[model samples]
Target: MSKKKTAMPKITLIVLLSISAVLLILLGIWLVGELKDSFSDPADGTEPGAISTSVSGGDEVVMLVNSYIADMRKDKTLTIEADGVSVKLDLNEAGAPVDYDELESYMKSKGYDTALIGQYKTVLEAQGEPGSVYNDEYITKKIDELAVNVDTGSDTEYELIEGGVTFYRGSERTVFDKAALADSVKAALDAHRYDTITVSTTKEAPEIPDLDELYTMIYCEPADAYYDVDENKNTIVVDHVVGYDIDIELIRKELTEGTWTEKTFMKQEILPEVTAETLPQKYFKDLLGQQITYYNTAEKNRTVNVGLATAAVNENIILPGQTFSFNRVVGERTAQKGYLPATVFQNGGMQEGLGGGICQVTSTIYAAALKAELDQVSRYVHAYKVSYIDLGMDATVYWGSLDYVFRNNTEEPIKIVSSAKNGTLTISIYGKETRPANRTIKFRSVVLETYMQEMKFEEDLTLAPGAEKKIRSGMPGYKVELYKQIYVDGVLQNEVKINTSKYSAYNGLTKVGPKPVVTDPPVTEPPVTEPPVTTPPETDSPVASGTTGEDVPVVETTSAPDPNSPGI
Candidate 1:
């Protein structure tokens, strides 16, 4: 039994030793495999403190995924360009990490069937254009194609009427065709990136009308005819004006539009302003167009025509602050104007047939002008002052020489209304009234003193061969001098002289009545040679004052007196 136990022990010992050795060999093989997997190639020497915790055998999978993402990032690019601008973009990791499940679904949705490959790796399982092909260059190219040219019209720019537009990029051509380039450019312009630029050009504006082009006239047209003041036949018959065509509309337009102001410098226009000017006694020339009558108690009734006429100053705006003169407007009246032959006061006496009745027109104009209170620039009275229009308020004219003038010192337009009838004349002013409507004007003629002078009058005188007959022959003539005064609103404004008529002295002529009857009878019978038998020397001795003899006394003409004599 003892020998059997010892042998068993030895056998067990040997078996145990053999098994332990095999196990040792297997353990060595396993260690070599693990070392190869863990340190396939020793980490680089420069690497320090690299820590590894979770990934041991699957490290290759993580590395592969990182490599794929790096590739995608490097391959990504974008180009953006439009108008004259260009830009490039390079993006890292342009693609995001692939979400396997979601990516698979997306791919499927994109009509691609994707399946997982070995080791659970998804190999573009659905090939969905890398999920979404991001071609930045393509987008940039599209935007560039949307570019446009904008044109802003300048001063000299030509008008644009457009057709289709063509665009070309190298050989790649496209047509937008009337796509409204302005709108396109507007859309493209970014104030943030641009500075304004300008272009030079020239252009002209249209011309406007001038003052010279406008010419106008003003005259009030009263109802024609006269007032029938017969009491019983008191009919107001309004007479129609012959050829009544007035440019009222045109005048109104000019006034309101201020166009009339353009002609402020016309040579003959009157500016109703008060200034220095000399007016002739006959200045109111406009009155010549009318028929007028004069009442002179000293003289017989007479009808005369006006020389000139005008409206009252202020009543008709003669444009404030302007110059106005009578001669400047009335022009000259010649025989062409038709004046009747009549008597006229000359050099203090009556002269026949020149320019007569002109005084009537002048006188009437004076009264009207005074009544209107126009600044009296010039005025004159009469020789033996007549009373048609009051005393100091009289204007007399000598045709082409004297004139009357006035001015409008106001700020508006004025109308002059002058009219004449068979025996009456009127000059009215039409415009803004500066004073109260009830204002009154008065005139006065205060004769300072009459200057009397002696003059000779010639009575009827006649001469027949040798017989002198006188009938109402020589007489005495006298002259008078007078003064005139003017008043306004009960105030005496001025005083003037109305020169009295001058008279000439009458000359007495000697007449001798011859004894001719007896001498002639003797000569015829006795051969007429006896010293003409001076007989009837005292036959009819200077026929006494009234007899068959008519005496003619010659009186020197007042106006034509002497060529070398000075005037009194």
Candidate 2:
């Protein structure tokens, strides 16, 4: 019996200790939950134990405080009352008297913990002193808003038509002093008066536009019709514009007499000198004249230069009395322009030069222009005769210093169409055909005098003794006269001398080795002297001949020809 009682008492003590330990654990959990609720925000709809001191939670608190202040200020309104003008504006739109930091410091000084700023926003709203201080920034902003609402003048209306203009008058305007308005608002706010603040404004009459200046702005001189190229490269004609003019004195008299209804005035119409219909007719319709010339396609650089120049001049139009400049059209020839070095006639000799063989193109166009009967404004002849054309027919061009220019003497506009293809270059002039069909014209080149070429020798050490190599063949010069002959129905009418050309002679060049050294042939059989045989006087033999009846000097010997020599 004693052992049972002792064991039962010990078991009961153990059970009581276990129940007490469980109850202490539960109590500790409940106390922790209550402490968590104290720190949490019930307004945030979070669980009761959720802590509100986290980084995001703190930012939310700050945002809520700022939002509250903004809402309170947004609901408030201020009225700017002036003479015959009133404007209402939300207080939030105005710049605050103090920035957020200053407001926060002011609130903190009032024994309000800004860290718990969300709770103190209502307290600040109730007090309202720190947020409502006199702010020059806010007062100026409010004044500007009120000024925009002032009764300014209505917009003046005007319209310009073909031969007249009309104007409509607007209402008179009123303006208030912005500085005075701002002072009134500041005073009212300083006095803590929320009533409508009345301020005065000055009335202003509507300004009348200067009729003289308007006349100048509206007046314009007539413009003639002109041709232009559109983006698609099609030739287009721009129509002429009629001019307008108005008398300011008449307008002033009407205004003084008070007889103006719509303030309307009739403008004078000035017609253009050249209307669209009066522009040159048959533009590029009729083929005036064309010339075709052959070129060596193997001369690749020269061919390229010819193509470039031709492309530059192709489809170019020259109005009547306008000049066409070859150099201006072709531009400076340089390697950058893709002009390669080729054989050119310079200083009475053939040498390599940029845009070398383009003279053929120039000469061809000159012929076409002559056939078209255009006026030659300026033309220069080559120093030496070119192989491609007759002696006096070729025209030479050099950029900046020399140019071949011609004027469109005809009344109609002229167009130049040029192309280089298949070893041939053709240039054609197109314009209205005013010439008689029965009339014909031809050019004649007459040789006046001949200058024979002379042989030139240069000593060379590379060749064997007494050996010779021909560097260049000789070119004979000539004084030629160009004539223009007119005929009617295949009958000669008249022949007119055009111009004279003097071509300089180019001397033939030869590289000769040193003369062979002479030695006595062993003095065998003393040489016997015989009476000098009389030789017939040496006659000059013609080595080269021209079709125009010019004589060329004879060469003493012949050798391999220079491959780069300029030859037709």
Question: Which candidate achieves the best lDDT against the true structure?
Answer: 2
The digit string of per-residue lDDT tens for model 2 on 260-289 reads: 347777888899888888765536788888
Model 1: per-residue Cα lDDT at residue 316: 29
Q: Which candidate leads the pack in TM-score?
A: 2
Q: Global CA lDDT of candidate 1, please?
A: 0.39
Per-residue lDDT for 109 in model 2?
65
Q: Estimate each model's TM-score.
A: 0.33, 0.47
| Cα RMSD, each candidate | 30.1, 19.5
The sequence of per-residue lDDT tens digits that candidate 1 reaches over residues 460-527 is 33433344333213223334443445556656667655444332333333334442332221222325
Worst 10 residues of 1 by lDDT: 163-172
Relative to the true structure, how large is the alpha-carbon lDDT of every model?
A: 0.39, 0.72
